[model samples]
Target: MNINDIKMVGIDQNTPIEIRERVSFGKEIKKALLKFKETYNAEVVILSTCHRSEIYVYSENIALKTIKDFFIEYFKVTEDELGQYLYILTGVDAVKHIFRVACGLESMVVGEDQILGQVKNAISISQENFASGKILNKLFRDAITLGKKVRTETGIKDLALSISYIAVKFISDEFKDLNDKKAFVIGTGEMGQIAIKNLISKGTKVYVSNRTHSKAVDLKKIIPEIEVVPYDDKYVQIARSDIVISATDAPHYTIDYEKFIKVYKGKKICMVDIALPRDIDPKIGEIEGVSIYTLDDLKKTADENKKKRIGFINVIEKIIESAVNNFVNWFKTLAIEPQIKNINKFADVISEIEFERVINKLSNIDERDKKNIEIALKRVAKKMSDLMIKHIKNDIINKKYEEVAIDFIDENGGNI
Candidate 1:
């Protein structure tokens, strides 16, 4: 009941978008899960995204065929047509595949954040039907925890995290309250536009500061209330604004503190410096109430996390191993449940025969004693039923259910 137990099947982006969209589990996923569960008797987990659609089930090739049959039957597909693109993973490979996906290693854009939430939502509906078993529950829970850790401990963030988002966080942390603040960004670069968009969305008033006042004036037309401060009065403009984001391409440092200090007579302000060969001085970081982020410092935390995602393989293995143990043990019980019911059916037949034989003898005993005698017989039958189930469960785990079933079927098939 460990990692060696359950089987898996995988499919990738190689399939046509038409086929992939047809199989997507978003809008009508519940309907598909219900059909898969009722028709195939599968403990199924389906992961569908832009890059791949994988099916993981706690069944062998026979069970897998039943699932494939359901898909073909549902889609009305011929065997040859279905054969074009599908990847199947069984045993340990299936276990590892899910771990990688939850960890974000298998994404079309690696380390993208949205897939984890999508995985959780799919499992939730499966559980609402009172259908999900031990395997999926363990795999998904472990995946979520591992994803959070990958973000927290690794420098992978520098390589993978969004640049616009990092800039937003830096601005908010530097300026305690920007509610009443007015900001100015000098350039019309993409980064400059992104910075302005983020600040305004957070309720800060913005002014465009540039040498060609026409571009700044044009920007003011789109944002009607944002005042356009003329570039000639740049130092005076810096004195008037609470936040300044300098992203201009000037030959020298655009805002040297020597000339710029003349306007600042110790007022609270913030700066967002995001230009190459540095728009702002590194030593300016030492100025009172002044802070700076060189290009390297901006994404340092994300860069530190790159290794954590790689090492997460071991942690993922451990979680998947634990999940497999629970799945196999539960699957063993699933196999035994039907055998237990059959044994009950056999005992009921035996009890009926004895009852018919004793019907005439029931008149000899007092009515009360006869009733008690019947209850005792029923209890005896129930006890025997319990014992047989426990014994069969043990036999199944030892891989002897086939022989037991063969004998029972041989004896019962013709008569039943």
Candidate 2:
């Protein structure tokens, strides 16, 4: 359970969205984690979202460079191309990074709630794929707990920022009024649904298109006024929309530039692509009277939202720091558990042996007297063992026993 065994290689808000999109695990995240396990025989979890792609590995056999090289080879990107964008973290740094991320401090929109779920999903997928082991399982579970705690105890959620919310806000800011605007949202996933609700709340008429029409219909059921456009005819609906937002997990461009150009009447449409791989083509932004925004473009709105939550940063950071220290201390305590168990076992064996010897020597000892003597002997042994364990733990906490009193156990011939 050495902290050094945990390492993270990642690129977050600092990296370019295009680069992130190229490296995202997407639908293959579970597969990639499985492959990581097969290759390194280590615990690994991949957290890929629109804003970041992180690989967390827990194993003495795996180096950060090994994971970096794995990324280069897996993403098929050259070293120079990927090297400059990566952030490598180890030990406590890695621990703090995950905690910060789970708490949404690392998000472009600080305190965004989506990332918490994404973090949960990342570890869950790894667990389901048998890719995450003891350390990561504990690490992620602790992170999730801290995430919930921060959200519950802090005012960071007052910022009320998310990719979906910000995407709509960005568009609403552009138009100044969304009361009568027509919004065509592609996809009915979490992001898309949130975007649709945001649009509707802005007094805008919302039309949704999904590959699964029933999902769109499901949205319509929630908001009867919401219209469901057939997925195949989404381009036609886009032509009539004042604003179009795409938030889907599709691999390829959902709205191709050429196809969009054919339907685009140059009527001044605002398109927001909140998808990782980018649902809308980048080239569409070049067309006159057509404005496009992606996850990267939402940074301006995120910056504004960050100002609103600046005061909460310190509070959130304190919570995260406390959680990180707790996790580290837990790992430290876990490291010496075997030694503690051995000591307790040794004490019990010696107490039982001495108790039998003394009781055997007593001629008129009743069952009650023998029981009291046995209890006294066991209690003495337990107290001694507890004191020794307490000192060992203090040594561990003080950084005075890196090998965790293993030498003492070895000297005692602890085969018992």
Candidate 3:
């Protein structure tokens, strides 16, 4: 198999929020992957989150244009807009990118733990849709393994630098004391859960709300002091709270600017939106007496946290490099084993043909002598074939036999 056959294309936090928001995939990610399979006949896995939307494809004959076209159609973006935002990676670069992403090295907040679970969920979804084949299955599994190893082996994740945690830190920096502040949290997803936990730890009273009220109730059970507001009453609770953080998986805006303008009193309020499609409308930020922070806005705090932990980066990078090399070596071995077997089979076939020719010419020889000669010839052939096979295997492992191996297969009619 060719290592360069794997490809990844996507937009991430590095892209402007305007473009990232335009290209972000949400619940329709599965439909998008299925469309890619139907259109390009490619095996794919999609990883879509608030910070990134990436598709990893494993196919023998797929072009960068084909992958880019899928995104242009899916995201409804023009070629110029897509070209400015899209990034393409192939082969070992693709593998290394995945490993780094899983390890949280590529996250907006370095050492954030949420990305690992997001990646695993993406892999599981791909498996359920049969969009993942042999190569992707192995690739994703190895990435997860490296993610776990990096976390355990390095000091990267010692501090809580997640976006949620950073949002709370931003709030704390603004209001020197949160002991008496009331905060409202929307959505009980991973980010919401972390935000609620951090808020409570800061001595802030928290109220939670979700489209599914049951999840809000469940969250309340974890922190009994926290109040659970019904989905419809989110606006009323928002008016009462000092801090409001909205992070839902809704496809559209949960908080309309016009609606918020009516309910929002002329009191100072801090709003933190950590959703991709944006739970709170951007227009809401324009209103007087209200301050809004999106995932992009939290980068300042993320950058500060990253600088403090910059020393551990080299250590984690070394770990990722070692893991990536091991995975590549294993893949190389798998690719070469079939050729090695075919070579040995060809040697056996030639030995048998020559042995038959000699036996036919020795018709006067006795049966016992003929059997003894056959045994000796077989031993000689086995030794010579074994030595040649060993040398070829070593050359392949050292990556020095590609041309010769291809020539051998071509000369033998592509078979033993």
**TM-score of each predicted structure versus truth:** 0.44, 0.63, 0.57
Candidate 1 lDDT, 1-416, residue by residue in tens: 44444656545667776676555555566777787778667577666665576666764334556656666666565566647676666665675576567656676435555567767766787787755677667666666666665645553333444444456556777776667688877776657766676577577898778767788777664456577778888788877777778887776787787867778767766776777756776666677866666557665744554455556545544655665555455556665455566677766766666666676655667778766666766678778877866676667666776576636644653243
- Candidate order by decreasing lDDT: 2, 3, 1
Deviation of model 1 at 309, angstroms:
5.6
Candidate ranking (TM-score, best to worst): 2, 3, 1
Candidate 3 residue-wise lDDT at 370:
79
Clashing pairs in 3: none
Across 122-210, the per-residue lDDT of candidate 3 in tens digits comes to 99999998889888999999989888887887757654568888888778777889998999999999899888876876689999999
* lDDT (C-alpha, whole model) for all candidates: 0.64, 0.85, 0.83
Off by over 4 Å in 3: 161-308, 339-394, 401-416
Which regions of candidate 1 deviate over 4 angstroms?
A: 1-5, 12-22, 60-62, 69-85, 108-113, 138-416
- RMSD of each candidate relative to the true structure: 11.3, 11.4, 13.0
Off by over 4 Å in 2: 161-308, 333-337, 354-384, 401-405, 412-416
Q: Is candidate 1 or candidate 2 better by TM-score?
A: 2
Higher-lDDT candidate among 1 and 2? 2
- Model 1's lDDT to the true fold? 0.64
